[model samples]
Target: MSRAASPDVARNARPYLYGGEEAAIASALSAGQYNHGAVTEEFEQRVAAFLGVPDVVAVASGTAALHVGLLAAGVGPGHEVLVPSFTFCATVQAIVATGARPRFIEVNSGTGCVEPAEVLAALTPHTRAVLPVLYGGRAVDLTPARPTLDTRGVTVVEDAAQAFGSCQGERRVGATGVVTCFSFGPVKNLTCGLGGAIVPRTPLEADTCRRLRSLGIVESAARRAETTTYTVDGFGMRVQMSPLNAAVGLVQLDHFAEAETRRRALWRAYATALDGIDGVALVDADVDRTVPPMCAVRVLDGRRDRVFGELRNRGIGVGVHYPANHTQPAFSPWHRPLPVTERLGREIMTLPFHQHLTPRDAEHAAGELRRALVKADR
Candidate 1:
């Protein structure tokens, strides 16, 4: 397939970076009260509505949302949380932040998600929660183990930072889990510049999350304005979402459907273009259920480093979704022999898949990748 007629896609420029949405954010800023107020509430309400959940509490970052959700779920010292080794460091950090031990489990090589069987095997009496990540925005079917967890009294907190509009079976990712955490960081599907949110199953859980976000305070200006006086009840962190970030988030939310459509199209383009390349294997994408947040492929036959180097030499920007978290120095003590995660971390390579890339750009990138693979083979 001669797919090389496109103009040069900028090696450094990502078509979907956030500067283009400044006007909407400026309009929200003009309303004053740039901290946490009506704008924040509106942002939260919109997120809650989008996820089909009852409540959403915005916080400073995705990590903070996970920490607060764990705390709100009553996870504390001596508790254990089952986490996937092949994920962003935030997953392990959240468990550690709650003063709980993270029982690292291996991921499924095919799906890049935590294996339910491995998670079940790791369950202990001290197990307080199981955090399954929606890696690359794919729907993770937890139905297979739900009954077992329920019987064992284990809570499921979904780490859905990469999956905002994803659906599993018939239920949205956030709606079915006891608590789900989302990130609005610069690179997430929804860019708030820097923020996160927690979706809880019930009103009480929602209220607790709200308190935890605001430094354990039971009341704030937003809450008091509805009543009379403000009150502080418990210790809290300054994890409240800023009006600035929320304003940006609201605009992002407004355009989310359109943005996701573009993203999905890009993913399909890459998948089609890269098919049958002997050295590269496209990561499994459940198009019907996932709105892929990143485009990744496995560089097979031990040529990962050579291909990665060649792409960089061609000025094509690539990324690694993560290294195996358990192998990192900070979390090494928790590391066990996770053969799949260790190997996948070495083989995985993330290609650019964002709202900005045109079909032609995708083709050109794939062409370059094909050339790189041929060179590596030689």
Candidate 2:
């Protein structure tokens, strides 16, 4: 199939790279440090500080971050990992990569996140972990289910790929979960061309994750630079972040506060203009706590596809955050009635989102969306 046409207002734009990123990349190139190096360490340290986590290990991609995190947490074959089917397929793929069986679960209709009740009901002796995604940068209150999870000895692997700067109460997602993963992909809130990070709560988990990011080698690239030889005592993969990507991440981190403010404002603009429209309504999320991953609205008139196409015709980009994962052929065996996930798969529509968009752009998108909804209704 031909590539989907880029819209005048992109659904999600590339990271806002500033002069600092250009310099960081240039410095890494001049130093001849292409693989993970001092720059990568600096980026990791900065992320650790931002998330208030003990330590973080940078990786090649968000998927890799999840895979290594599972391994570090000791999830293996015969183990089951509970995850919501409303999220991106990468969450399931990561579980399969570690030889763990993924058990699909329901999400709260309002938040599009897995609720504690659903998780509690799904917990079994084979369940080794629970991967709760912060849907659209909205925080999942794990507190309600923490007691059950703790009693069952289940690890909480937070998928904070879309929630790098978001928080619940005083604690950030990364700081509260057993291990949290963040994505710094091309279109994410914090873009690094391509990179991710694993925030481990303990020193041992951090070391394990660090080794897993590399080829299970005990020593990091920086350490091997000083000495020619390295050792590998555990299984691992070569998923380390490149210095170039790390440089971009560092710059993005530096400017995140300003970018976050702009992103939140744009999200609020959409919420103000789009909420309570005749045929569509914005999904529930805590704007005060979330960094606003995307502006997703639920079409109530069974016309999500029509609205999406109409918006595209008007040069406004739109997207479906995802289809229900359980319905996919690969995960068919795990398929069951996920009423909320299935409904959302058809109702949720993602509008043009990114820090690059302005309040005026948001209003325009909202107006166009309302027109599309009206047309779909007709």
Candidate 3:
């Protein structure tokens, strides 16, 4: 594709649509099965099979996946969940949504992931769960901390919104035993326009998550249609993935291998280009095992703001992934000192990343960063 034909480097990220997506959406519309339908169920099954799991529960969005997963894990009021403060606020808000306090933990600066020691150290008498955010699509291995967590009865629910196609050890991310949640948002590795899924640990947990997403209705949609009465058992929310979005997801899943390959190649191209550049350090994604969502770097010497400004002025897209959430006004009541996250808030920068751009685009973006760094220092 020509530079003009493609979404140029000025775009930080956008959904990469393969052929037939429009036709799939049209077919779903023609069927007129907008809500819980055959299409959505098929999407769920395909996702479960791909991850080598028995079942996957579909939901409206990634946040919904976290909320439902937490609730299904028996997390509720009077509980404390250990979580990293370096991630997007949605992770923190999900804990708050469950009426649980988030005990903020720190992450390693190089990978932007919570270390095993951090999880082990943050534990308290009220701790009920450990929520690990898979930043930049890199898997966080809590193997060393699992024994203690299990002994304490603290469940691990991973926030894998950015880690859809990434791997952990021998199996893919969601296939791991822990309760994992994934987002199929527009710009994610897999796009459903707007959707998410939960990989439950047991068949029982799967049923609970399904019920939670469907407003605690005891009967399935088919079962309810044959009867005059439907039972609402407990507190739940209406957040099922729509058939329209599922149609898009099925098409995207068919072409997911291409996404994995291209994303890895683009990340490598950026790594090669940025090598030996002073005043910048690449945030390692363990690219051999990660399908990176973005190429992140730390700009040193308090130069990130100026470098970001320079790139934007030159029409090269640059972004900050997140600000520290613990210090936010809404979460201040639960705040604990996180010095590493505070420093990362000032240094982290993300370059333009998406499947639409080629390796040449990666080179161009890195070149622009090098030039901006020179300008910022002078």
Local error of candidate 3 at residue 223 (angstroms):
1.0
Name the lDDT value of residue 129 in candidate 3.
Answer: 97
Better of 2 and 3 by lDDT: 3
For 244-312, candidate 2 gives per-residue lDDT tens digits of 999999888888898779889988988888866887878876889888778888888589988888888
Q: Go through the candidates in order and give each one's C-alpha lDDT.
A: 0.83, 0.86, 0.93
Once fitted onto the true fold, the runs of candidate 3 whose alpha carbons sit more than 4 angstroms away are 1-7
Better of 1 and 2 by lDDT: 2
Report how far residue 368 has shifted in candidate 1, in Å: 1.0
Q: Pick out the ten consecutive residues of candidate 1 with the lowest summed lDDT.
A: 6-15
lDDT of 3: 0.93
Would you estimate the TM-scores of all the predictions?
A: 0.93, 0.95, 0.98
Order of the predicted models by lDDT, top scorer first: 3, 2, 1
- Residues 1-378 of candidate 1 have per-residue lDDT tens digits of 445433334332243545546876787678887768788888999998988877899999999999999988889999999989888888899999999999888888777887678888989999999999889998777778889998987888989998988888787778885788999888788888899999987888888988888767787676667986677787578898988889888878887888778778888988888987787888886876787787889998889999989988887777788788888999977878888888999999888666667777888888889999999988
Model 3 lDDT at residue 33: 86
Please list all clashing residue pairs in model 1, or write none if there are none: 215-236, 215-237, 216-236
Number of backbone collisions per candidate: 3, 0, 0
- Angstrom error at residue 142, model 1: 1.1
- Ranked by TM-score from best down, the candidates are 3, 2, 1
